[model samples]
Target: MLGRFRRKQGANTQTGVQEQDIGVSNSVEQQGEKPALHVHMPGFNHNGHKVTRGIKPDGESGRGGIHPWHFIRICFRSTSHISMIVNVLWPFVPAAIVIHFARPDLHLWNFILNYIAMVPTANLVGFAGQELARKLPKVFGILLETFLGGIVEIVLFMVLLHNDVNNNLVPVIRAAILGSILANLLLCLGFCFFAGGLLREEQEFDEVISEVGHGLLLMAGFGLLIPTAFYASLRGSIDDALLESKTLNISRITSVILLVAFFIYVYFQMRTHHGLYDSVLEKDEERDRDRHEDLKKAKLTLTECVFALALALTCVSLHAVFLVEEIDYIVTKRGVPDAFMGLILVPLVEKAAEHLTAVDEAWDNQMNFALAHILGATIQTALFNSSLVVIVGWGLDKAMDLNFEVFNIVILIMSIIVVGNFLRDQKSNYLEGSLCILIYVLIAIASWYYPNPAAGTSNTAEGAGTKAGG
Candidate 1:
């Protein structure tokens, strides 16, 4: 709302003009060999105002009109918060419209894979921004990076969606998930330390922000666990039989009761630790304040940011739909379920795009935010996105359960193992990243074969339930 108008005061107008005038004055003073005395310039009346001639655009006494730098400075100086909002939100309009149209065509697999691709594009934009930052003044460089990075992400998502995707998307999903995690944990964090070492030892991390990240990670893990346990149960005939009998009965009400209980437990736990939570909130506020100050110093308004964000989201939605269709096509040819395709193939393909942002962010001194992005994305996909799939499925004609079958259990276990390792260390090297990639590859390979006799079960019903929980 504040970004809707231009500034009328023109308080910052003199700055750009002053810079030009000073530079010109210095250059002229240095041109002649003699020490020099000041001289006056000729004046003329123009447009109801007196015009000084021979001053050039440098804002000198006898200079010409406004210089290019001065003009740019004025634009920056004059724009108000209202104009900023327009700048930022305007780009998002196209993005939102695209997403709105494309949502029907997208499958879960496609969305995840496309998200992976977006990461890389974002990183690349970040890197380009870093380069620009080095070349330009800090304010312009950072703004350029933010603006371009946002645009790049949206563009990539749109491109990915423009195609039809189907089949074997599981690999892509899995690969992308790993890519996001590895880039954030290993690439972003590692590079931050490496590059940060080049500067001063006084550098500190945003602990409050880091705590939020930790919370996100924990939530993602728990969300995945639901699907994991459900899938594991399906492989166990005894457990599957019991659950099936109980779950199939509308009058039984056991599932609902359990869910309610679980909700209560979670609520109470949160209530108990609310103070600790408030500490995290306080820290977040501090970080936000600091960020705000930095942004203002850099002469960037939030509206430009909003515009870029909206555009990116739109492209991402479109690309996500395309990716889903392509995966479905590929999977049908390969004769695999859409879920498996999402779990495997889609992620692998999407990795190239996802890392772009991470790479770019690493180039900047913005590792903390980059880390947040990776972890936050993962959490959103695992929890919020997955949850929405289930809720929406319920609203649809069919009761779509997202139960994991036996194969999904393996994936879950593997995910748990890797995530645990990742969190335990909190510091990742290139080797760790490679290991994650290797783990994903192994899982992909293993998913292609038939299950053992002990593991064999009807894949659909249980798979649906587990997938939903996941």
Candidate 2:
């Protein structure tokens, strides 16, 4: 519904002007544009009268128009209520500090405080990323935004790797990777559609976004499948020792391949095929203009953006360390299922800010932006963050691989298919969103009962490494 006709009042009219306006309107129509109507988008309605005034054929002023949000400011602030709440959670950071040293036995409390504290820092990182993104050209900005958005997830993964003294966290890390993807695909996107549907009966976005996201996800899923299948097939033919070695080698190769595919995707997205995304970007611009935040310029300066990002990265890294350290205690001592802890709890905390942003974008009728954010982040979790963990594991010699449990991979592939089908028409409603969430709930329930395998016997590289080392 974006760019629909909505006539504005106060335009000059005079004798003989009608004929001139008619000619201009016809010319505008021939140019494939509506004759200078006030911008109208889906989910909102306004009574408009036909106007005789001349509107630029470009349909806008220079680079659209700049609203107050585009004004250069010295400070950075997020107007989102979620961001405010995340900001309020900042006190938990210091609380985590005190509890870690003062009362070290309270592992559960330490975990809660640290993860809660992480919310604020991750929000800050996203804000800084967004602010900095607005400073660059549209293409690079989108790429940068996606990269920085996943920084928290990446950092947490590395922290888990660094702290996995017994290989216990490796399974959880693998689960978290799949969990993050599910979170974005089902949870975040579900809320986006549900929220957007609350405003508009049905909303539509560019199919290209869906195609790209789904294609890449399928590719990543295939990468996951190959390694799992290899492990399964060879686990029978070969002895346990040889099978383990082959699995790790295959997983490492898959990681490199996925990374290569991701890089090629970046080029395809930002270079030769950049034109494919202009529709999304244009719609995003129209959405901002509708909200009177026509930010063709940035709200923060280079110095403020850099400083904010630095502080955010440090805080997120620090709190992530705190959170990872307590996982063992909760899983082993507290009897919380590691599968549930990884697949359900971890993603909720890690992607809190992103979920909020998606919902916000949907509420504002920016379905394109919302969908792009969701799909882009999910793709990042698959190709970038997940691969980094394997390669990082390779360097550390700590036995990490793409050998996710067969059950988990099946769930992942099915979820991807479900999401891809929903996106087939490039239209969304609350009902579709609800279904996605329902499936996620089912997955969570299943995970709640999922067994926490013994440290060395879990379905990961640890078993193989242990066998060989022994």
Candidate 3:
């Protein structure tokens, strides 16, 4: 009976062991078939390891994932930024080399280098102004941009007037001022109309704004004409000294009047008649909605904007210094008349970036903004910037008179008439644009051939001075 009991106990123990083994195998099989637990939190357990919720086992996110560094890398590789970087850097190389190694005798090289340098500097100023404008109200923003846009030309003229050893550059300066007016009225406006009209059949803007701007331009033209008329009347009778004194008096008075007029014009545009200037239609509004969002995205912080302006102004001022110092040498060496330089090259240098902006606005079919830009620039050049030059010249004892040449006066009057006709209806087409451009081209060509007998003698003296300094 004892033997039989022992055998039964052993059999019971074996059955129990078999049951335990089966349970272990089932548990292993169940674990192998089970899916992973995907927790949405950053830190989650997967099988015994902690993994980020969105990241895969290899530390990469699933499809459609974008890393911050990769995004930044892509932006830096974009075409526009790359081109801007190139523009900002390449010009400096020639400028630096010229500054270090060029001699006054190498006037051509100096002029080329200085001009190249000014291109980027001018662009920087435009960029800075645009950035600042983005932060202001529309009216104030436009005014600020106009002011900033004209600053370079003002500074250049001042430097030229201040450094005029023989009182010869006065004509050139006058021509430059006149050229700026013509450029805005004819070249810039014409191009804008052309670009906009090409894209669309016709473009329309606010007639009231156009009329007001045209009226202001007419007043400025008349104001300029006073000095010229006075000069013509007394040309044969007055002595040089007496004529100069009278001219100074007239310039100072005219400048004050222009300044007052400028303020009144600003008040009218910004405060009283603000609504007249905005010509946004429903379709335009819809288009600009997206643009507004883009602008918001691109907007700079206040501190950044200020810093950019400061930096750009510093660079532009430096370039202006280089340019002003070498202009006489350039004029002397190239045998090019100063009037031509002022009418063509100087204005081109000062207005290139601004011109690009006007063109772009027109191309985008923002005719109102484009027209405003052109007209505002024209008015600012005529009333504010040119007037400031006169006042500043008087303060500095520089003989800057508004006694423009007959050619300049005639051109100004003709421009007023042509532009008046065009803006009368506040409508523009490609044909009108073509006509304006044709006029500008003819004017430019005539200016290239225009003779200034006085320029030769002035250039000789300037060359002598340069040689002495060297």
Best by the lDDT measure: 2
RMSD (CA, angstroms), candidate 1? 17.0
Model 3: per-residue Cα lDDT over 1-470, one tens digit each:
99999999899999989898778767877888543444454353223334434333322122233344543332222112422553555457356446635575665666677677766666656665665574465667778877787878877887777777656566678889999988888888888889888878988776665788899999999998898777667765757557657866897899899989999999998898776554342234344423543332323334444555576566666666667777776666555665577787888878866776677677666677777778888898899888888888878877667877678788998999899999998789888889988998898888878766442132121222222122
Tens-place lDDT digits, model 1, residues 45-114 = 2222233343211122122233555333422332223222222323343443355456734444344444
Clashing pairs in 2: none
Regions more than 4 Å wrong, model 3: 1-90, 93-105, 278-293, 455-470
TM-scores vs. true structure, each candidate: 0.46, 0.81, 0.76
The local distance difference test score of each candidate is 0.40, 0.76, 0.69
List ranges where model 2 is wrong by over 4 Å: 1-79, 288-290, 293-298, 454-470
How far off is model 3, as Cα RMSD?
Answer: 17.9
Model 3: per-residue Cα lDDT at residue 470: 21
Best by TM-score: 2
The local distance difference test score of model 1 is 0.40
